[model samples]
Target: MGLGIRALIMVFMTIFTLTSVANAAEGTATFYTPPYVPSSCYGYQNNGVMIAAASDAIWGNRAACGRSYRVRCTGATNQGVPQPCKGTSVVVKIVDYCPAGCQGTIDLSQEAFSAIANPDAGKIKIEYTQV
Candidate 1:
């Protein structure tokens, strides 16, 4: 390929990398167990291990099906103080859809959730990256 063409490709690659890095998102996380809300949405249930769900209002549960995300808890905050995070990251595959009033970046299965935060927290601030 010509030098000019090579340079153009390099520039495009750089732009793509930057754009993906920009997509790293922040949100809240929670988990559910057993018969997931809307149990019919299972993608790869793994007999109920390492499964996840996202809000139907955002990506529609099936859209994220088969995709996994690396989730890390940022902290807990009921008011405005951000506490120390659990510093754990776990990969969970999308396998179902959470029902109404489910406000979170992703809804993880009990196993996946416990891998990151103490489930007793109910909800926690989180940052996740698709890997």
Candidate 2:
């Protein structure tokens, strides 16, 4: 191949690689919660913490909550895919606090928890990019 043509191809390849790297740096977080309020009064609402059990199949009975997270959703796993989280982004306020030894990352509300996790699965993977 001609020197000029080879040089042009190299330039284009470099640009494409750089752009992909930049996009991968972006990140988000997500969680799954119960669909409706539980019959038992075992839930709490702290200053920013919210915890509730799922009435549906996704997270039935098993407790899942969070203290703080960036994003939450109930969608397919996007582990390798870039920016998999999608749906309403809710701002959680810490009204109360969870005691020691809480299982999950954050104690989320019924609505917040349900967004990213299947009640049956009871757990959702979260991703975030540090600012």
Candidate 3:
């Protein structure tokens, strides 16, 4: 390959890698059973099944409300399931607080969790990005 062509390829590869890294964030996720209403951000209002609760790390004093995040399961958090990801992603709205002692970084609704990972896994490693 010509020197110029090789340099161009390297530049494009660098840009692509950086863009992917900038958009994704690693976190742990767990599913919560129904009765998703009466959220701390929205009281008794239904926000659909594609909803989640932000952990203290991203709660930002309730600033996370109404925000949407795209989440993909990366792996299982335990040996109960060696591979939990279904090779899909789910976009969920932040409608509540997961609290300081929340078991996961984001508490996803059962439907949302099932979209990305097996519900039986309970908790899984995830890659997410605000959208």
Candidate 4:
């Protein structure tokens, strides 16, 4: 192929690769459970909530948990003194996922949980928005 043609092809290929990678990272988030005792034992009701998961490498694993773009959990503990019963919203990145059929709500690092709601509530509904 001519030099110019080859250069154009390379550029197109690069763009296509980047587009595919971006699309693969995109995902949708939704509510999983409600606040209750035995915080770790709960089931998600489909269509309960909707959130966004931006272009990230975290979604590559089905059993990853950590700081994600956002996390919505119902059974959050309020942080600090004077705890209250309130929902929790956290911005976390997924480091690993829960085991298959594992009970409890989405796991999050203590740091992420403190960012949105208190840590004393111990169990509250949560809704997070992707940033």
- Each candidate: RMSD: 5.4, 11.3, 2.6, 13.8
Candidate 4, run of 10 with poorest lDDT: 45-54
lDDT of 1 at 8: 100
Q: Could you give candidate 2's per-residue lDDT for residues 1-131 as a string of tens digits?
A: 69999999999999998875454322222333444232233343232234332222223233323222344443444344443334554445322233444444444565555554444434445432111
Question: What is the number of backbone collisions in each predicted candidate, taken in the order shown?
Answer: 0, 36, 0, 28
**Which candidate should be chosen as best, given lDDT against the real structure?**
3
Query: Which one is best on TM-score?
Result: 3
How well does candidate 3 score on lDDT at residue 93? Answer: 99
Cα lDDT of model 4 by residue, 24-111, tens digit: 3222232223222222212232211222222223434442322345555543333443533235545554433444442224444444
In model 4, how large is the Cα lDDT of residue 26? 23
The candidate 2 region of ten consecutive residues with least summed lDDT is 52-61
- Put down candidate 1 lDDT per residue, 1-131, tens digits, no spaces: 69999999999999998987578688888888776544445533444577677776445536776677888888884666445356778887776766778867788888788888877787888878888
In model 1, the runs with Cα more than 4 Å from the true position are 1-22, 35-38, 43-48, 80-84
TM-score of 1: 0.69
How would you order the candidates by TM-score, starting with the best? 3, 1, 2, 4
**lDDT values of the candidates?**
0.74, 0.41, 0.93, 0.40
Superposition TM-score, candidate 2 onto the true structure: 0.35
**TM-score of each model, paired residue for residue:** 0.69, 0.35, 0.86, 0.34
For model 3, residues 24-108, the per-residue Cα lDDT tens digits are: 9999999898899899999998999999999997899999999999999999998756798999999999999997789999999
